[model samples]
Target chain A: MPLSSSHRVSRRNLLKGAVALSALFAAPLIVSAPAAASAAAEQYVASIGKSILVVAGGSQGQMSGKFRNLMARHAAISAIGVFSLGKYRSKLPGSQKSEYYSLIEKFVAGLFVKYAPQFAGNRIEITGSKARSARDVIVSSKVHFASGKAPLEVQWRLLKAGSGFKIFDVRVLGVWLAIQQRTEFTSVIKRNKGDFGALLKFLRSK
Target chain B: MGVLFIDMVGMRDKGVTGLSRLLAAFCIVAATAIFIAPPSTLADGNRIVIQPVSDDGLDEIEEPGLDDPFEGVNRVIFALNDTVDQIVLRPVALVYRTVLPRPLRKGVANFLNHARTPVTLANDILQGDMKRAETTMVRFFLNTVAGFGGLRDIAGEAGWEYHSEDFGQTLATYGVPSGPYIVAPILGPSTPRHLVGRAVDILANPWTWILWDATTLESISPTLGETISARDDALETLDATREGSPDYYVTIKSLYRQNRESEVNNGAVLEEELPDIPDVR
Candidate 1:
């Protein structure tokens, strides 16, 4: 039953080769898990930046429609409304709240369309992104003007919702867009003596 | 003389002089030990020599008291600035915007920005940021040479980054507190620390020194041009803000504070944690 030296050496080599092959296959799976998760977050931020740049690239007349559709598809309009409403969210009925959100979303879309054309021909460069939490990521970008003006810093806050990500807010030159809107909305509500209907009427006029 | 020295040595060995010599030797050894001893061991060895003082008490006393305590005064100044803006700056800015073509205005702004590069470069050095200082110098050289007296913004076209640094930011880098918010007439929002920093900046500014040596009219014209051009540029945003906010003063104040803080922090803020201030009118 004593094996020849050549046969024994060949059998040992085969066993070693099998173990090495399995490690090679398993190494990537172990190493790539965390990396793949971070990559997904980065990809999500890049997509948001690309969408903004696309809207910014549109012609003056087409900007509003383009931005409105982009907002409808990619922005978390409901979450924004809730955040801006603050304590007032509890006071409004669910149906009225939904209506308010739609009106506000349309208003924002119109505003974006009006302003986006000004950035036409400008290059948007996505600088970097950082994960805020499991469900939130912040993307930083620079809007480089074609006229050789200084680039403006813009930050987008994206939140994970269901199977996709939605932009919850944006900050330009340190001023949070949603925060500014909330202040304005709250002021109007105060003037109307806490009447949400008056706020709705104001939004409608806009 | 040798016999006298021997006689003195014998006298010292038998009297107070010898005692004094022993004391001097002891003092020399003690001083050397004091100088050479490790500080930690010395503290334990000579408790009476080193007093035990707690820094915890000093920490509370020396903490910075630099927040917006003079809101009422600031609000009054802000109102004055607004009135001036309404009566003078706005109309002039409107005319400036409408009269000049967009490209022409951009050229003027670029030129003005180029002229101010030295100020930024100086502040960069004060902040101990040598990298930025080098960049600013390079930018200034490129713009002045290639952009034709900095009118064309050729440096920007070549992808040279523009940096705007002020003495206030330099002070912030050195851990100086903002020291209470104040809105100055014409100058708008500032803090006490910023006001002092501004004064230093004015002294450091090459333009100011140049103006000091130039004719009165020459001194006055550049400032006037800069003020008007800046106002013209900010016109759209300011008007939009005025129309968008019910309380315009509060909104501006809040925005100014937010902007300054962001500059101090170098624009680092967690997006998810960004305050949700609504933009709606």
Candidate 2:
């Protein structure tokens, strides 16, 4: 009976997971509908290069949560371009859990707070657009950080989800946050607790 | 490290297929040869010459053997491992991490942790070198039973005060030369020596009997649970942080090969500095 809550949630979660997976399987087709819509939006944003537009419905938490979940599973994180251990276990006798968590913690804590000036409330111009697929669009923009580091180039890859487009991935000047997660996390985790969980707790606490 | 490894053994794929097939044949031949290769053959260590297997340079693969059927098998094993963790083990780990009492968790950690060795803590104990024998016995016992428990903290601490036993380290101690790098199906990258060592380690596993003889469902219950819980705790950033190229598999294989080479060549030394361990009664 004590296991009931976890069991029940797990069952529901499994079903939800199934739905999510099916969505991924059917994604290319389901997303095509919004490709044209997103393309139109991209075209509109393209002309206004250097100008920022507030597009409603995209949640940073959703993306962050998904990204973190992937890391927790120790799955690969591909940001701009680097691969590091996203999990606690590695090829040696070290605290993989602590290492994984520490890096994730810093990135998670810095997520919106650090990135806010770039895109949160401000408007940046969409200088260029390259559509990789009906579902995959790479839109480039330049954002002046609060600390003002000369408007860095931000590449946004939006994926079609149902009737709307969701932010599938984000790369800052070819530097993807996802890929950087492993390298940064691995270094910090190895330093702090010899593992990955330390980073996770650090982030969650933030 | 990259240049050194390439110059020595060349890339892993240079002639791996041919080499593996040769090694596979060699295993059978060597086993047969053991009976016929003469008594002097077994006695002469000097007679064994380390011949370079192959040294072809890297090939720019047109399609690359990414879709090898063997690779698919390895992927399936990995996926199954993931599925077991996701479906059965993760929730349990979450509960364990969340609901477990601090003291009890600490007790578990102390009992399970073996990230370091007692010799490393020699000077801390007033008993000094006198406890070395006892320490060695205790260390061996703890590492063997609780190695897979994920609880290796001494005195409820989060990490182990010392290091734990692994196949790679064990092989190095035996003075077995690390043959060329290899990427095993499902197991990922290792060397010929370490690969053989891993298989031997698995065979020697004390829990193997419990796992194989026990009811399949019951046996997998704990492993799957632990794996999934570990996975969930890490699910958040698994993808976005990957720093590999488009050919992620090649990158992983190469990285594993390179890291193993470095670890072995550099010798298996603990990279972290741990404080002296207090005497354990």
Candidate 3:
């Protein structure tokens, strides 16, 4: 147990060497993590656009079941629904939470279905993306229609999930669809004395 | 200041004059706590990271959407406008685009922008946006001196991008309501607030003053050129929106309102606040 001075010096040196070696390997991984996240976010955003195009290609302005499912899978429907209710979130009929969520999903999908015919055969190009936080990335893109029209701008705000991302909000022409809905939904609720039924009817109209 | 930027934040750090400091303070106050544009729009040096996170974005959205109570009349006018566009405007713009090369057309856009600089500068100052005012001033100076009377955008090449500020956006900044959407025949989508703002802007413009008493066709030439340029640029985009929508009038009404909101939301820098951006660029 009583080591010589030379032996003690040799042990310390070996420990230091091991620490240095590990750092050399670990430093890059740590530094490049943000870059890796950015890349993933960019790819995810681009794929969403591509998948949309593929879904719309054969549908010809129709919302195929597949398109509805795709929207359901990516969108944070419950959160969006809850947020859109604003002050009336508590009044969203405890028995009808799922119904509210589904309606929100349908409302969103409806807009796409209505606009899909023009978008069919169109190309979606991912322009760039920047992180809002570790969990959020704003991915900017342009949709170029096959009819030789000028490109349409789209910005998607994605919230990072486990090994993937979920759609949070979208900005078109400087207005967020979710935010727009929130405005309308809250107003309708306010006008109807916080009637959840009225809100549902409004969504139905959309 | 309106619709996408936060600039001149570092001037104070660089020891600007006392008058500039006073003006900057006033501008910051006038901007009314607007968020800065996203950094991705420009080069690294031009990017300003605003770090303020405002309270729930919902607070801003609760305001009612623009009223379109005149649906019947607006639709009729919109139909007429569409007919006019298809018969004349589109053909004219197409011919104009064909007659002028890309460079020439761009030159026209640049010249128009430069010609409109006086009104833009005035709006920027009126909105108390010193940063935007400076940007307008520098851009006007550069283009006039080296851009051959703004037939070329030398300033744009120098990284001084062009952003137009108008009286409509200025009016919005001080909490003016956007009354109702209107289809003003040749002018297309507009609101009462915008109509008033346009009248003021025309009067505020130096060209209007110069051409007011003149007995020449020069006064309408810029208007014609602008119409053609805008139509040509938006030809395909408008067509797509039109074809896709069940109601082009309703779609345009929404787009116009949102675009106006976007314009008013761009302004003085706030650390950590997000700004609304226009789709134009």
Calculate each model's fnat, 2 decimals. Answer: 0.26, 0.00, 0.11
The ten-residue window of minimal lDDT in model 2 chain B covers: B272-281
- Which model is ahead, 1 or 3, in terms of TM-score? 1
Candidate 1 chain A, poorest ten consecutive residues by summed lDDT: A33-42
**Model 1 per-residue lDDT tens digits across residues A36-150:** 5445655766666667777777666777677778788888887788666554544456778778888888778766755554545356677776665556667777777766567
Q: Write the per-residue lDDT of candidate 1 for residues B1-281, one digit (tens) a residue.
A: 11111111110001011223234334433433333323332221211122223222221111111244556777788788788888888898789888999899988877877877877888888888898888888888998888888888777677777657777777777876555556655666655545555555555566665565566567656556666777776665666666655567556755665566566555678444354323322
Q: What TM-score would every model get versus the actual structure?
A: 0.71, 0.31, 0.56
Stretches of model 3 off by over 4 angstroms after superposition: A1-154, A159-163, A172-206, B1-64, B267-281
Name the best candidate (by TM-score). Answer: 1
The whole-model C-alpha lDDT of candidate 2 against the native structure comes to: 0.39
Enumerate the candidates' DockQ scores in order: 0.16, 0.01, 0.10
- Candidate structures ordered by lDDT, highest first: 3, 1, 2
Ranking by DockQ: 1, 3, 2
Model 3 Cα lDDT, one tens digit per residue, B166-234: 776788777665555566655566666565666566656666656655444565566666667767666
Q: TM-score, chain B only, every model?
A: 0.71, 0.42, 0.72
User: What is the C-alpha lDDT profile of model 2 across A1-206, one tens digit per residue?
Assistant: 47776566677799999999999999988766555666664764453322222221135555455445433332222221112433322322334444443554446534533343334434465666665555455566655444322344566555444444444445542334443344454444655656445545544555
lDDT of each: 0.63, 0.39, 0.63
Which candidate number has the best lDDT?
A: 3
